[model samples]
Target: MFYICDERGVWPRRQRRPSDCSSQLVRVKLIGEVLAPFFLVAAFEPIGLWFTAPIAFAIYLSFLKHQHRTILYSIYFAFTANLLILYWSGAYVGVLPWVALSLLQTLYFLPIGILARFSNNIPLLISSILVMEEVKARFPFGGFSWTRIAFSQINSPLASIVTIGGVLSLSFATLLLAYLLITKKKSVAYVLLSLSILPSLVSVIQDSSEEKSLRFTAIQGGTPSKGLDFNSRAMGVLNMHLAESYRSVKGDEDLIIWPENAIDIDPLENAIVREKINELIKRTNVPLLGGAVLSEGPTNAAMLFREDGSIGSIYIKRYLTPFGEYIPLRSISEFLSPYAERVDDFEPGQVLKIHSVSGSKVSSIICFEIINDGIVREAARSSGLMVVHTNSATFAGTAEGDQQLAITRLRALEHNREIVSISTTGPSAIITARGEVIKSLKDGEIGSLSGEALILLKISISDYLGGFAPVITLIISLLWALSSMRRKDNN
Candidate 1:
């Protein structure tokens, strides 16, 4: 149960043995530690990514969590594990600057580790993880919900279960699956299994509304270069995407989607860019939902420039990247990740935005927001479909990023919405409501995929109307276990 802790500045020292794995406490910590990340990462194996990054993260968190160590240890481990991979790959670019950023992010796990101390058994452990996740999701500048377990379910046929269960429900479903599989619990596992598949089956059966495909085109214009200054080359990046769009635009394509940072110009200003957008829509004769800065700079946003000669609705991004968008400390951020010239700061939108396009209201959670299951749920509650606009120009070239993309696909299934994720680097495609990638372009690949595919926009689902079911189920399970624990406590 030992772990790293720092009250203000009192740093805990490391364990006596880094290699030793004999202690029961350590073994429990180790197994529980690696289990979550292992299955999660394994879920991404279908994609090109090696299953190590997520697994390594889980192992590091295990040792770091229970070691008598410094807060700096957690930070350093987070930074080092990430940087070590990047440095080994000879990727001398965006990741180096992110070393510190990763360290800062590791703090999110600190409280989760602390909460795990109360979990004496498997059920409690699972409940504790869910509760800790819920807590981490709320505060400290809106918790980073990256790497949710639900995302890993994309490749599995179980993804359809998301239609009825939702994201919160996924944790329970995933855990039960993990626990039963890991422990070989075949006796009563049938009920849990049935619970998972039965709803999705009924949903597909009861809902036979035929899907209507909308012809759409999505494009990702490559950056000027991977290395060197990204700030000065903004115009170059913008032009490249515009040019790519021109090549990709087809008469039959009804909708065109660009990555989160597609528009290099500020939506409010930039007369020439404005004129070009109108012209592009007019020429293509189709709606283009492209990413841009709304007010200025870091405020990443999306705009729907329709072909009908109207100012397309603007969607300002609600969740902004904490350190990247606006820095933590003014002093540190100024020196570290400064706002690019002509870019003030990313303005935050109040909530998730869904704009009407081609007779469908598509809910969007820009870039980093895609990882947040809660945000996706919020948007899925009131939209025809969900889309994620992302920019992964800053990542370890290894397929590690694809793991996140897999999560996006799983999320599509969760809400039963067609998730069209258009990213800056690549992996842009149309993910079906079943969480399978129908078609996708790899990283840094140029061009677009346009075709008429049926997209179902629903009024609402049973899960949507009863979101509290997931939360309530979690509460009942936790209370049952805790009550049992209390009985044992009295006994």
Candidate 2:
């Protein structure tokens, strides 16, 4: 239907491929597309009995390209990969929630794919990918910001960039590397690759010394067990965690933390619970931070109790899960209807609360807040450490619980902050500022995991300040390196 002129200026009309040939290519394309997502999901291989991060990046890359079916392929790949992450933890039942998350999260990549089609300029493409990904992550239900590209480098050296751009900078760097590798130039590729490996180099040296970390302990008392009243279950949970805190509390232990809902009763209404926490603080002689129900009808707030038993600061969960937290009215209005209850479902904790006690400043993020990177970044800029108090009971004691913990581990590295992830159903992990898991509680156990969180003072080079952004400024220095190539091209 179209005509083309050759070098000789002769024109020829083009003919369409045969119907059978087109059909065959479509069939081949479909098969490959289906296989891509499946392989993407299986990337998270088992470590001992649990999963690790290799597959996470694999699924993420499967969505990074530009193609006719790339969006569809990315969605299939992302959703299926999430499904596998959920399935690997338990059975079909365990995967149900994540299946829903993936279905929604696949939308996060839609705008990215659409944007890539409009232009092919690599720099523009990179910016569009990062900004659009960030934007979609904020829409259609508070944006599922989990599985960010920067998170993939937590165990790797690329983590150092956090000291410069914060985690947002790492995400941008990740896209830069992805763009460079996807291209065909050797010199340009070498420069990008060298920059990509810088974060890991910084992390290896920092994880060794921990500089001047303050010793801290996190306690997990497990979830509400079967046949137990909320009050007694609360007592049982309280006793187990109390025992752990006591063990870790030397005259030197700086702070102590407990997982979300560990104190099951609404702390505002229960004077006895408040007194018990105060007693524990008095005995341990350290400030305590943990999850407590501060309000009735779903206040879902985390209260910071100073050693004197006075409330220091409160961080209410700003984001709540749909259906899990409150049911929406129609599908969309559930967040708004009298039944939707978006603004009122829980009194939204409006400000980031940083509690200063003893020597260090800490921010307590209740469950679901860590899924939002902006909250952690804002908290990090204002505070020294980030404390996550989460209860994974609703996850039904599966590896999905571990996946959540692992994601937080990465956040610690991305922001270069010491992280204490205290979960009600085990996996109470102590992660250094570089995102390495120092110690953790055994999953599915009804006990606590305690460690010297205060003593870990290796302020990352990124943390020590003057981060890799200066290195990025080396773009000018690269002009010298490229001069040789430029001269050859000129000749």
The 0-to-1 C-alpha lDDT of every candidate, in the order given, reads 0.61, 0.59
lDDT of each residue in 319-377, candidate 2, tens digit only: 76544454544454432233234233555667877777566677888877776756766
Score residue 355 of candidate 2 by CA lDDT. Answer: 74
| Runs with alpha carbons beyond 4 Å of true place in candidate 2 | 1-33, 42-71, 85-100, 112-127, 172-184, 197-213, 226-236, 243-252, 282-286, 321-323, 326-344, 454-491
Alpha-carbon lDDT of model 1: 0.61
What TM-score against the true fold does each predicted structure earn? Answer: 0.76, 0.71
lDDT of 1 by residue, 1-491 (tens): 23332443212344243333346655665565435434334444333233333343444434332344424444444344333322312233244345554554456555545543433344555565566556555656677555445555554444556666566566556665555543455743885778757866677665657456667788877787653344357677778877888888876677888887777667468887777777778888878888887655456778877787566677777777665575455565555444322235567887656788777667777877776656777787777667788876655255544766777876776666777888777767778777778788887787776655555655235346465756775786698558757766211
